[model samples]
Target chain A: MNKIPALSPTVLLAVALLIYPLIFSGAFYLDVGVTFLLAAISASAWNIVGGYAGQVSVGHAMFFGLGAYAPLLCYKLYGWTPMAGIPFGIAASVALAILIGIPTFRLTGHYFSMATIAVAELIRIYFGTWDLVGAAIGLQGPATARGWWDLTFRSELPYYYIFLTVLAVLLSFTYLMERHRFGYYLRAIKVGERAARSLGVPVQQTKIRALVLSAMFTSVAGSLYSVKTGFIDPESGFGILVSVQMVIIAALGGAGRLYGPLIGALILIPLQTATNTWFGGGGTGLTFIVYGGIIVLIARYEPGGIYDLWEQISPRRWRRKHAS
Target chain B: MLLLQVIVGGLLLGAIYALFSSGLTLIWGMMNFINFAHGEFVMLGMYVSLLVVMYLGGGPAAFGFGAAFALFVLGVVVYLSLIRYVLRGPMLAQILSTFGLALLLRYTAFWIFSANFVSLPQTSLSGTINVGGILMPIPQLVAGVIAILLTIGLHLMLTCTTIGSQLLAVSEDRGAAMLMGIKPDRMQALAWGLSAGAAGIAGALMAIAYPWSPSVGETFGLTAFVVVALGGFGSVPGALFAGLIVGLIQALSAFWFGPIYKDIVVYALFVALLWLRPQGLMGKA
Candidate 1:
């Protein structure tokens, strides 16, 4: 057990990302980096509930989609500042997170995941038919690349850095969650809720807080997603595939670890980039087949994910033995 | 006049929905796995039955009632291969594996059947049948009758049969059943096979009555999840009642508030039900 460092490898990873765009000047490289960063942030947020707290939510896109829509809706309907709307997105997402988490948290794994998926579909249906957000016609911006109130951007670089900051905050937060008393409560609940409750852990409160933080983090990422694309739609935000992406990312990177989501995103974005560039128009379905297959393989062999591999190789065991 | 028309049409549609929800609930109760790709099973059954229609000259009436049995075989295939292995794994594992299965089945339908929607040709029975002042479509009535028959048959099998008793015992406690000389694995396999077969029967019935695309089953699958959740997980009777309840609620909500907020009503109902009653209506059982 080597001494747990005050500054983790993740802090180093964040620093690396800050400097990455400067060196990786290629268009393809930039695209991959930005995509991974944004998705990684959202996946990390998902980890708070799905990974750390031991809950699986398929309706995560509700928060993500709401995050995308809130800012866009504010811009379209009320002419609010983009930065200001982010807080509103975070607030709405938090409310939804609590609304969903309070009840569905009672469900263990698949049922809970299924509940989330159903909620996402319900949200999608509402958005598709509702007239408030332009209904099925969808909301389009008056202009693009204007950078007014941070509603649009000239390039993807600013958006990348924005998500990178969110990722750093979340990674640091999750690291602390691993060490805090609440973290243990979450793990215990994940292991067995009855036993955890018997041991005096405030199970419901802990789960809800974890989800609240998760919603806040994911919604911010959604806000960035809309700004990057300068468009908002029901399918893009609340799509079932987006929920699947979080599951795959968390599983791939190794759920419950601080850096697992980022590792998962790094692995997936490159594959997605390759598939997108190679297959072009018709490759979409095949790309998903490959995407889903990766998760199946991970579930079968490396259920713990890439983090487990690193844990096995590192001298942390020796350090622990030495300490004992 | 429109009010009368909507109510009649909605009830007829609700009956069609009941057919899909029954199998979904049965699978949930017996196997403790909600087959996310259940809709695709329904989709494949439709295509298979469609082929039956094409081969036997024309129309579902050619096979008449035997079409449900045809779906039974496909269900057994789905069970023996994919589902049997994934049972009793982690919740995430079970869910994702089935979701993968759903994805595979849906995409396969996309490629094999083309993306085009398919339906049986209209006949005299296809039009609305009038009863007193109320008019209901003939096909929906047929679907309603078949769903009730299947539901009753399932109830008897679950309660009275030797295999059904074994299924109930294993679902309650697999380890204890194995200790008592019952083969838990074999029982699980049978349960899965039976559940998949139900999905097939439901699918065949759906295609016989409702027009279908490769993805149409998805709508029902999502709703079936809501129905199962609301009805209480693993309670077929609860699902039957809940399906009708949700069906009427959705229909009435859509009629009054417009379709825009219809799903919100169902979702709100689910959230409230789960909050107020976590074990579900039958969770106490």
Candidate 2:
């Protein structure tokens, strides 16, 4: 028997992702794929600060909502192509991250998380009432493609490619970050703040930097979401559930690992989509039950998440040398 | 005259906030654990009250006690099952575990109850009381008084009771408490029970006056966190003072700036407060 060459998992995943649209030719599956990539993008972005820096923000949806609003706002108000608003979304998210991070980073543990929630909720409430963003009525993107720049594709295939490319870039960036000194600084901060400061890690600055980068990418993910969905609302874009999903997804895959969120999105999005499809609106309860169950199980059985769980169960020789 | 009415209304609401928040603060003080599902416990309390009224044909007192008893048992069960396991886990695990529990509880409620908003059927606690030209709804007045009494009662229990000391001892130092012959597990379980019972009573009280759905927990939960933080974690008396203040602010803001903006005002103040006094009003430096 000829032994099949041992291609690395990363390469295999990449190959599979690149050809996913071709294999899953149906619109439904392609849409699911796109949704998965979008979720992965946001979760991975969240991982930058939440996973690596160990600051568990429960209000990242504020940035995602801001990003979602930008593109839709541009289309609605200025009649400009939604893509033109991506930079503005990124800018707003970066600025808000700086504004929120400076003060919130002072808090530790649950205090920090609660502060984020308060701030994000405040923002969401403001946006809901603010007429410029269309108030509670929300904003809509292009109904139909005004031009090629409008990105209103009839098929989900284009979005799959677009989102896949974004995910690939984000993952690569995270991979590079893992090897960089900044990544080390983040890990140091995560281990313990006072200790990291004692070791001259510039703890506050490092955290703020991670948050800014994280917010920028999270904003991009939101913008992409609005582009695909062609609408943005306070509830859909800025809800607490949005923030929770990101944290849960990142946690589920083994936070701090490069592929953790990707793995999380891979499992969770399909499951959520399938449940919603099969059971309709009533399935929402089941979805939430599943999410809650997963969170409790992971926290109880393996806080390191599925990745660490696998590492523990896998054969010694098969385990990666530096699994963590 | 209108201002006085608003202030009175605010205080009444604040009393309820304090009642539930004391439970949250108790948990934090005892275990340094934030129960993300504290709101769910309150939600369950409301449901328990509703069921008591619906099936048991109970009055306010009966349902209130029923809710508290149900939630107290639930808190103990939760402590024994999920919380005990994650207590030693990473902060991430600790946070997410309760969060998951919150989701599970919330959605399970949704599945069982459906998503419709429900109110208690006409009970004996109906009508309003005119107090010095300010008409206070009977339910609100009664709920407020009961909530205040219960909160103070809880505070006194902690300071005066043997069980209270044991709970506090475990919280202050688990190893030392164990050396002193106190079973840390039992005390912690009791703390959870007491904490959840308070939340349950608050929920039951609120159910008498306010129409609610399963999702009401999120609002109450966030409000409890704000109250706990404002009052300084682990302080029941602080929760009382802070709850009253928050309730007043919310009422005044809503009256002045429309109801929609009230939450914005509360949260803005909360964030600002966190920045200025991260230790909170009564928290130890």
Candidate 3:
């Protein structure tokens, strides 16, 4: 069997995506595509810490919320553009991550996960009551002229391209990290933090660095999400479901792998859109029910996720032939 | 006088927290597995109580006991079917299995009952009693009393009974217990049953005072986690102590700062406490 070049498939996929808007010319399809890209970006960012460092944080919605609200609040209160607020949002998320990580990183496994949830809940409750962020009413982006400065677009085309670009950048970043010494250290920590530390891996520092990177990217996604949606609320911004979705997407695709989150987003976003369309008014949590079932089956049978499944089912002879 | 009332109210609320959390702590101690679906178990208990009252016209005692029995069976079934298998998998699988079960149970309730809130009918446990200048709701008082009694009873059972010794032996060393002719599976199933039964009773007791929907489990689940963590993951008495402390903190903070900030106070304290003592107050180091 002839081995295909690694970059060819990715480039082909990118070309296909670029021409998709031109071919489809429908807002719904563009919306779904953008959503997929956004989910992909978020999940990939999460993979840095969750997949690589082996720290499962359920409170990542806190960074997402911060990324979302910082920009919206600045726009609402200070008459600043969301573009101007993005840096501040990223900085705030990083700072908060440090504060949270300092205490939470001391604990391991489930304890750390629980602590993250608590912190996120605390922030959610605070935002729910704090009037400065409009409390539970949430904040709306100002009605502005269609321009890159404000990040508001009349058509979904620009947002689609922006999301695609962000996804590409993040994917490239993850790809680099995967082959780098930093990535190796993270994997080492994941296998055994104590052993990693004994091997002079600087376990805490490495974990924090991974988490900061994860938080920064997640915040960027959050800012983009809020600006694109033109609204931000505590529930929508920092909802536990949002955190769970990121985890699910990463896990489903194959955590720690370069293309894992993208694959996960592809599968999940379409399913989410379909379920919401079909069962939205029915008040049945069918989407979540399916998600739950998938998580169980994956965890029980194949903790390696879909990527691992793919590897197993792929032709071994082809894989070995392509190793060079 | 106002502070006294707040303190009393907090104690009552804390007792119920302890009651619900004891089961979670027991399961953790027995198997080192956290039940993410524990809140759903309590929610099911609430619905069981509601069903018994609506259909069978049972009083508080009958419905409370009914919830316990029903959820006890559920706990055992879940252990045999879901938990037992997941336990052998990775830590992520163990955590997410119950999480999946939680979503399954919660959404099933949503499908059957819809999203609307429901409350129990006025049973024998109603009204309030005034002591000094403080007015105590009778239902809360009874729930609190029952919660303390159940927690202590569980503690005593673990310390005193032959079955308890066998259960502890299995937890201590499954192979050793097997050599002693103890069935680890049966004992573990019983622990799950007891844990879930306690949650059911807690739900019934809580239903007396609080109107709830299927989503109520989220709040209870988070609270149970906090309580169990605070009390020490595997300690029944520690859960009781932590639950009361949390309830008291919540009540006092809610009174002083406002209702919304109450969670902030509890969680801040919780995080700080965990930071200082990662093993928790009573958990083995």
Best by TM-score: 2
Alpha carbon lDDT at A253, candidate 2: 95
**Better model by TM-score, 2 or 3?**
2
lDDT of 2 at A286: 90
Write the residue-wise lDDT of candidate 1 on B56-97 in tens digits. 655554444344555566566656665665564555556666
Sliding window of 10 residues with minimal summed lDDT for model 3 chain B: B88-97
Model 1, range A1-324, lDDT digits (tens) per residue? 345453445457767898999999776788788899888988998988888877777678988988888777877887665566788889988888887777767666665677677778888878887678767766655365444565466666777777777777778788788888988998998788889999999988888898898889888888888767767888888887788788789878988877788899988888888888898966777767676567656655566788877667779865555442
Model 2's lDDT to the true fold?
Answer: 0.89
Candidate 3 segments whose C-alpha is farther than 4 A from its true place: A1-4, A322-324
Mind listing the fnat for each candidate? 0.32, 0.86, 0.55
lDDT of 1 at A119: 76
What lDDT score is found at residue A80 in candidate 2? 95
Ranking by DockQ: 2, 3, 1
Greater lDDT among 1 and 3 belongs to 3
lDDT of 1 at B50: 75
